[model samples]
Target: MKTFARLVDDSANFSSDITYKKGGSILSMIETVLGKSVFQSALQSYIRTYQFSNADHEMLFEKFTEAAAGTVKDWCERPMNVTRFLDPWFLQQASALKK
Candidate 1:
């Protein structure tokens, strides 16, 4: 899929497809890039900080990037923004996962 629906209409019927699976794959990529412990900590921090508060995608991007920078090993350093890093996998077709 070129893009995913952020919110599905309640009146619309749900379809099971690879696009639905993509979200989990993206999280898996994050866990692979950052260690599982680091990813978990970051996810928890995001939830705790934004609980009962409306949080946008930028907030999530910032939290994950901050956590990765602090925890990821020196060799895996990334110079790009976390949102940019993730956008390709999210916006492009499913083939991106092969990388």
Candidate 2:
């Protein structure tokens, strides 16, 4: 799988397969990991905080981590904040799946 960041460099990578299919899968994983309540709250907070402003991944991650309240580490089964947990998914060109 290509990284989300990589898709921006080439318009060719912009397709329903990547943007919708894979993106939906990734979102599902994140929601599952963060739990519905925390995930929804984080998204709500992010939108509310940046509705009329610019927001980057780091900003969104900060909201997620803040809403997680340290439970991200437990949910991820490792010691990591939302940024660390999501970096590979967004920044690296590989499957973020871990067994």
Provide the TM-score for each candidate, comma-separated: 0.66, 0.71
Q: Runs in model 1 with CA error above 4 Å?
A: 1-15, 73-80, 93-99
The 10-residue segment of model 1 with minimum total lDDT is: 71-80
- lDDT per residue as tens, model 2, 1-99: 775654355655656466676667777887988899999999999999999999998898888889888666664476448887787787655467563
Superposing every Cα of model 2 onto the true structure, what RMSD results? 9.0
Q: In lDDT terms, how accurate is model 1?
A: 0.73
Q: 54 in model 2: Cα distance from truth in Å?
A: 1.0
Off by over 4 Å in 2: 1-11, 70-72, 75-80, 97-99
Clashing pairs in 1: none
